[model samples]
Target: MSPSSCAVLCAAVLSPCAIAQTSSSPSVPAQVAGQLPTIEIRANQDEARADLEAEQALTPGGVSLVDGESLRQRSVVTVGDMLRYVPGLWTASGSTGDSSFISSRGSNLDATNYDGNGIKYLQDGLPVSAADGNNHNRQPNPLAASHAVVARGANALTYGASTLGGAIDFTTPTARDGAPNELLLQLGSHGQRQGSVTLGKVVGSFDGLVSAETRRFEGYRLHQKQERSSLYANGGWQLGDAVHTRFFATTIDNQQQLPGPLTRQQWLDDPRQAEAAAVAGNYRYNVDTWRLANKTVWDIDADSKLTFGLSYENQQFYHPIVYAPPFFSLLIDTEQRTLGSTVRYQRRMGSHDLLVGMNLARTTVDGGNFSYVPGGAQTLSTSVANRASSLELFVMDRWQFAPNWTAVYGAQGVSTRREVRDSNLKGDFNSINPRAGLIHQLSPSNQLFANVSRVYEAPTFYELQDQTPGAPPNTLLEAMRGTVFEVGTRGKQELGSRNRWNWDVAVYHTRLRDEILSRDNPTAPGTSLSINADRTVHAGIEALVGASFALGGSSAHRIEPMVNLTLNHFRFRGDSTYGNNVLPAAPKVAVKGEVLYRHADTGFFFGPTFDLVSSRYADFSNTYRVDSYALWGLRAGWTGKDWDVFAEARNLANKNHVSQFSVRDVASANAAILSPGEPRSLYVGARLKF
Candidate 1:
């Protein structure tokens, strides 16, 4: 209860819907009062959504986009449910599926391994994690994504190297100029199922699209099970009208099972006990990915334009993790390749507008791992390789000092090199980042924005192979650095004849210098080893409010409401196993709400959602607490005129929560191991267009 008192109690409960939409009243049309005064303007939404929201507000950093109709209206399955509401992201999913982990902001989790806290992974922009030292866990198949974008914390500087918790761009969908065909199916509740298909065509000068998906699950513990599949394609061509070209492709497959973690007296005696005892043996995981991209567009005259792109990628993964006894069975294999190129330029003068870019990337990673001892005896192998390269240059400008002001400036420069083979360790880095922004309109649909940026991050190969001993090894991890500060605001209004409203607010701060920690040692009782720990600080605030109404319909029913809130303030300031505590698994409040009902001309809809979390601490010596939860969900839909149907229910109640925790070394002390969450589920789906 502090974070400015929960942002002043959410701005006093939204100040009465912003003073009843600024005392609304505006709507008159009866033609001919003085006969000669006409002026009404409001047209903007083409040019591909205003050039993708002005390239997401003059992108220099801090991007967030997540669309695909909000990931099929929040049914996002994994990638930790599409980034768990973003902002300074953090995600953890345990009890198998390779015990997921993702971190940003206050970084740790073994410093984002690939080599150590210099995060990088892209799908429609190539690079798919893996470059030896083994951090292999690339499982893409969120229905083969059609939208995703995340760039925060370390300002990716135009994506040409790992950018530490900054860079995730996945897009895969194209061809629509009067669509072609589509299909989908789904079923749910622990034994879930799914299927999908899509196709589009043009030929002659290209213009194509193809898609596929498959999913299955039997999870909710007791020997878990999962499966996934995907395929994708894209194409384009024009060559005239200022020239153009494009291409893309994708593929993925996965299988999963692994249900480990229990302790604390078997979760207080029977939390479905099974932290290994040979839970039926073969717990599996497998993956494969491929991508290719090319783009070109050149006008070069009449306000200038020239753009080009090239890309390629390949990825692979197979998994396992264990602790001892006849249990030790490990095998990991990886291969990666990437080549990239980019050059972009645009210009305009008078009211100013310019952009310039240059980028290059090269990557290779071959890896190996094998172990089968502990009773199955004999088998050990290790072979690792990695090579990396990056370069970038950028400039941006936009000035229009009047008509309600606007200004934006940017600068970026980066260089990187990394090579490793066993222990030859080599790393080189360089940086220069700068950005400034401002936008103000204040009326006529309101607007105001502000920004400032400078970011950098580097280190990986499991933070430099700190240690390796048949998996579960870390020798005091290191390599992490950071700085980020932000400010934000957003607006929209018009509420009277039919109502409307919107709001967004933000505040942030992050500072770290060598922050990376993950230590856990016990050794003889129940065993332990979790490594890494150093320094930290993280701060936050985020808010959102939305509304829409028109319930008294002339048959165009509608009702909408939304709320989102988050307030975090992690701290560990210079570590000693978490000096100031709090930063272990963060979570100091998070809330979400929604109610949407619609029927605009028979395309029906219904909704209800609520989620909340608070109370956390799973180590870093905050003693061990993990309690605080609330969940509710439901949805229904139908939209005809090219088809759609849906139903969803998640965690309805049935609470037995605890999504992750660790620390076990029993025989006398140190015991805490939980990871239970997931019960009550339902999903039903359908979609099509042609």
Candidate 2:
């Protein structure tokens, strides 16, 4: 390419919306001609970024693309910070930054702790969650990602997802996507401190990015402190003109001290006190992990493409919970390993767009259980080795059957197996999920869409390890199978120079058989005992609406208001014991949003954010209820080219309330099930990019 063409290409590549060239590109960029450093735009990165956006637009279901650039302005400590503006996905802080009790579309509707299920978590589009269908608080730190994609429920066919909550893929940046060098610092209440550094560079046909971050937080309540450190890196290579491959590496270590649940009386008296059992047992949770992955994309032809990926992970986990005399406490020493692979092919022919993919994964866990002896040594109780493997094949096609109408259809078939040695358990499962949808385009930017689909989810290790024989297959738990129907509309309307509006609303209903649920173990209050519910129903609305209005018709000054809300009605479907009882743990309603004032000329923004959650049942019997709560926060920030400064105050009212709680079959006033919310706290942060 000539110098003039190179200039144009460079401008296009550097633009915010530029797709950029693939791994194998032309000679050095135009900067080389200007006596500046050369930059190589990787092809594989371009494909990943472009495909995510394109794929999301094609799905006629609940989907969202998160803006990581905007998120950098605030204190990005947890996954909650990355998803607070997206509705339907619910999360609650679970003692630490990486641990967020999460659920979506009523998936794992009643799970009580930080370990998440139903949702298939990913980093750079490779599976991070185990194959046995448990994420278990192992989500990659969102701070390391440059952006994210969320496909809710059955809409995630492209990623070969069969779980009810669908998929969340975090995308990291290359030098072309982010600054070559960047730094972030944060300080907050409760002895909080955080720092991170990121470096990126492009050399010829190769590009690399690396980052390291660390954090420490002293709990407001006793025995709740947490410390975490993580490192992330990715490098891309151009094998040839038609093939591009990228490799990723990550390592993380987390240490957390548990402040066990409190009784109703304990909460009312002093919400900041750690549970007596927790203090006595020295309850703690710690984990160390490392992962490696590779993705290769090949351009088959002008209208066809293929992508292949492989990932491997290893982890060591230690957790000790409440004391019980004979056992004192359940001490867990576990080492886990997981390997995942995927292949996808895409093509466009006439009016039909096709996608076919395959996903395979396997996980192995060597676990040791010991009975704690207080001040003495522990005694070996039992040992087990768990292995799980899965294979999935999926295909999807969208055809424009009419001028303004399109039809979408897809099916995914999965075969899985789970085995436990020493425990002497073996189980095999198979499922076929199908999806059908239609879209009607009303205008260039307005559309109405609807979909009906099927979902299946198998039990994870958490539920399997603590089993007490209940039914056939001996002590086996049945998988959950459900049918979902949904409808929604999404679009944006520009109304003159002073106002612009955007909205996305979706309503869905699901009928499930044998939904996996958990309740507090009677003898060990709040200790989860998983069970299968015969019948259940989950219905909910996920909506988001936002508007930006220019003050006095001047673009330099504006006011923006946005709201993300989810209303859930999850309950038993005429069960013998709990007839029409609402599900426990997950709240019925959630509201989060912000209203901001911005001075574009000076790059200033100020906003007030809030969270309102409805009261939730603490027991399947509906006799125990947690109180509804509201939290308010304020944020102010200024942005300059390559720089950002921000400050925020959270839980302004300092309300002492139950932020989260474990569920039970029946509850009493003395039951220990409550986790207190954080008190009023302030945080300040700054970011510099070069």
Summarize candidate 1's per-residue lDDT along 213-233 as a digit string, tens digits.
Answer: 878877777666778777777
What's model 2's overall lDDT?
0.78
Report residue 687 deviation for candidate 2 (angstroms): 0.4
Candidate 2 — which pairs collide?
22-42, 22-43, 23-42, 23-43, 323-328
- Per-model TM-score, in order, reads 0.31, 0.91
Each prediction's Cα lDDT score? 0.59, 0.78
- Give one digit per residue, the lDDT tens place, for model 2 in 19-60: 111111111111111111112333354444554544554578
Shift in Å, residue 36, candidate 2: 39
- For residue 314, model 1's alpha carbon misses the true position, in angstroms, by 30
**In each prediction, how many residue pairs overlap at the backbone (N, C-alpha, C within less than 3 A)?**
12, 5
Worst 10 residues of 1 by lDDT: 21-30
